[model samples]
Target: MDHILVTGGAGFIGSNFVHFLVEHTDAKVTVVDKLTYAASRESIADLPADRVSLVVGDIADQPLMERLVAEHDAVVHYAAESHNDNSLADPSPFVHTNLIGTFSLLEAVRKAGTRLHHISTDEVYGDLELDDPERFTESTPYNPSSPYSSTKAGSDLLVRAWVRSFGVQATISNCSNNYGPWQHIEKFIPRQITNVIDGGRPKLYGAGQNVRDWIHADDHSSAVWTILTTGRIGETYLIGADGERNNLDVVRQILAHFGRPEDDFDHVTDRAGHDLRYAIDSTKLRTELGWSPRFGDFEKGLADTIEWYQAHEAWWRPHKDAVEASYAAKGQ
Candidate 1:
């Protein structure tokens, strides 16, 4: 594709993918974002202006999307109300953005005959048992737990329906937890890392035994690019890097890197309906697309993420206090 339109391109993963495209492809990228609290223009500010541009808008704006989709060779749908905590507090935005927004995008793509790639979360498969031998795959049943996940599940279904019924050229990828730079401080990893930077003990939810299969954003970006270019239409790919680490271990590793005691953190109430574990088996993606994650070492990737947060304090600092206060209000 010579030109691409990316929804939610100002947010964490989408912005990373935009950066990846600039470095890896000759395509010109136009990013449409609502500029929500979780997204930052600064994330994309330093990218080459000649190659990237931003349009302030919502994906649910049907007329706007129709115009934009008609211009780009392909669309990568990444816009969604993604925070589980926020979704729990209020599901209205989640439903509107994740479901209604996706429906709007699908319609636009169907009309424009544009190729599309839908981004989704592995949480749609719900949580696995802490000791389950099997991981989530393309065939895994949908068992979403939270409003955030349920709406994402709904959005994924919309893409499949559009593809089967309307012959819309689209592919879907449900990725595991992503950790890297430019992530909002409200997220788990960045929240803890920033707490440490502020000389405060990191807060843990419940026992901190919940496991998340982590993947670096760079790797996720590369895998998505691979799928968009080479994956089969109507195929669902699971993207992961075998980087499974439980919450306790993740916090300990963060404390270790900072020369603090591992058990210095406090335990907060766990999230309602929080899944116990999430693991992704990406064998099909690797075997079929010849794609693999570069950040195989979870510890090394964690360290690099810490370094990025430390170096870019100015980017995330303004929001740190408000995020912590919000969590404190909920006793989390």
Candidate 2:
């Protein structure tokens, strides 16, 4: 049986990937997570205990990583400080986790001669001009603007280094924004859905003109799995559903789903250095791995996502207090 190791397996995308792996493949999966505030084990509450092994730990710990890499057939790295606003507030953690942590994992995999699949973000391409018709292809130049994306871009280079210098069989995937079930409430889709459901004002950053290509988390996970299993070594694949929408349009869609008006949002100042637009060209992954996103429709996907959050208050409500406290601590 193939034993696969997943870092940050308790996180939103990581947790979803874990479930997808266990259900779809016979691989003996080991999950190593630091279980930070954003990571809730409850996300995997339904996973069978026997098929999965959860290791509570950090990926930057070289010793633990070396051992895990030696034992597993492949490593799927998903751990990182992902919040852009939080990264702007403090960049050290992003550097530590996204850059240093990725370096540590690459070193471990190199020593053990193991295969690795690194998950990356399209934010590495920075912002696109409104009139720029080009999407972020695999060959796009790295022009990351935010501290968070800069660190991720740094990590992507390291993955390439491992493949070039050390001959580590590695594949990288850069994906667009993800939205679906089990997402943290702090994220836009869930936050807006929950707020609209409870008769609260949705917070908007600036004029909410920022555009993003959103993909369902399930589609993203499937793309990751496909790339890991079939992509060429030392290559990069862009994973996107090609569903682009401006921030305000997404917010309006969520509000409409809840039978609320579009003007229910409280517009606020834009975030510092916020990227105006991000879109990905996933044609490479689709053509090479025969992977196509099944949930590319924003309207239907947003509706399904909103409905999931509405019906799962037991899963989301407990985190409300903690989420509020985090914002309060951040003084947002």
Candidate 3:
């Protein structure tokens, strides 16, 4: 697509995707973001005006969505209320932003006939048994555990229905946990990194045995682009890098990075209904689309991420205090 509308483009993964577009493709992007506490204009402000334009707005606004969708060749939707803790505290925003917002975008695409690609998460497939040896594939059945994941599951279903019932040109992808530069300190990896940066200890939940499949955000961006152009309409792809690590292991690595005792972290109350493990088999994306992660080793990827937070203190410093305070309230 030559001109595209990206919802939530100022947020972490979306901003990373926008940067990836600027570097890898010729498409011009118009970003629609609510600019919530999770979003930062500075994340996208440095992009060339000719290539990227920011529009402060909500994704659920039908008139606005229609206008932007009509003006662009496609919509790469990344907007959602994504935090699990916030969703638990109040599911209202998650319902509005993730469910209703997706419905609005689907309607716009249905009317405008714009090519659409929806971003979703692997959490929709719920957690797997630690010893299951199975991984989530495109055909995995939905079993969302939290309000945030449930809303995302709902949005993915909406996209599928729009494509089948209305013939809207659309595709969907469910990606693994993403970590890299530009990530908000509220997120797991960045939270731990910034905690140590500020002379605080990293915190773990329960026994810290929950496992997550991790993929660098940049790799997630490239995989999305591959699916957007070459993927078939009405199909779904699972994106991952096969980087799986349990919570305790990841925390220990973070501590080692800071030259602190690996056992320095505190155990916080575990999340309500925490998923046990998540693994994604991305064979389809790799074998069909020839996609592979650039950051092959998880430790290497994570070390680079730690270095990023070190070098870009100005970018993350402003949000550090407030994010930690929020976590502190939750005893995380």
Candidate 4:
């Protein structure tokens, strides 16, 4: 069986991708994660223990990366400091993990001469104007605004450099905001769902008008799998479901699903340097690779996501205290 190394496979998106790989392919999967406050091994509890190996470690550790890369057929890197709000509070970790950590992974992959697939966020394209009909494409120039996106942009450039200078077989996928089952409660969708279910109001930033193209994590995971198996080296693909919804609209939808009134949620001060909008065009991925999202409707997807969190409170409750503490410490 082909063996694949998945970095940050214990976190939200990373963990989902691991489950996808295990179920869809015959590949033996090894997951490397730092298991930070956000990551949980329970996310992957359904996988066969024997086939899935979980290594609790940092990605920047060169020796460990070299060993993992040397043995795996391919590497899917999903580990990074991903919260925009957290990045605004402190940028050092973003630089350390997103930029320097990615550099370390690149070096290891180069040394091993292994194929690498890197996960990136659409925030690297910076903000889209509210009236701008154009969607972000793969060829869109990088105009990262926040520290988090800027660091991610730096990492993307480094990956491109490695592919060009070192000729390392690598590809990158820039995807939009993802929401689905097992998402950490800190994100917008899950946080709202959990809070609403527990007789609390969902917090909205500013006037709640920031628009994001949200895709299901399962669809995003499947796209990652497609890129790993068949994508051309050095190519960057954009994966999105074209499901655009503003913060207020999203929360209201969740409220409606729960048979609660929209007025129940509270509006809070907007985040620092919040992107006004982000939308991605996945035409390249759709036309060239025949990859399109199976979950295309935000309403249905949102309802499904809410139901998942409702049914699995045990899985999410443990993280509630930490989530509150984090926000309280940030004074958000």
What's model 2's overall lDDT? 0.89
Residue ranges of candidate 4 with Cα displaced over 4 Å: 325-332
lDDT (0 to 1) per candidate: 0.97, 0.89, 0.94, 0.90
lDDT of 2 by residue, 253-274 (tens): 8777777878988886677898
TM-score of 2: 0.96
Q: After superposition, how far is residue 320 of candidate 4 from its true place, in Å?
A: 1.6
Query: lDDT value for candidate 1?
Result: 0.97
Clashing pairs in 1: none
Instruction: Report the lDDT tens digits of candidate 3 across residue range 1-332.
Output: 89989999999999999999999999999999999988999989999999999999999999999999999998899999999998999999999999999999999999999999999999999999999989999889999999999999999999998888999999999999999988888889999998898898898889999999999999999999999999988989999999999999999999998899999999998999999999999999999989999988999999999999999999999878888788789877
Per-residue lDDT for 207-245 in model 4, tens only?
Answer: 899999999999999999888888999999999999998
After best superposition, candidate 1 residue 219: deviation in angstroms?
0.3
Off by over 4 Å in 2: 322-332
- In the predicted model 2, the residue pairs found to clash are none
Q: In order, what is each prediction's RMSD in angstroms?
A: 0.5, 1.5, 0.9, 1.3
In model 4, the worst 10-residue window by lDDT is: 323-332
Off-target runs (Cα >4 Å) in candidate 3 are none
Candidate 2 or 4, higher TM-score?
Answer: 4
TM-score of 4: 0.97
After aligning candidate 1 to the native by TM-score, how far in Å is the CA of 304 from where it should be? 0.7
- Ranking of all predicted structures according to lDDT, beginning with the best and ending with the worst: 1, 3, 4, 2
Which candidate comes out best when scored by lDDT?
Answer: 1
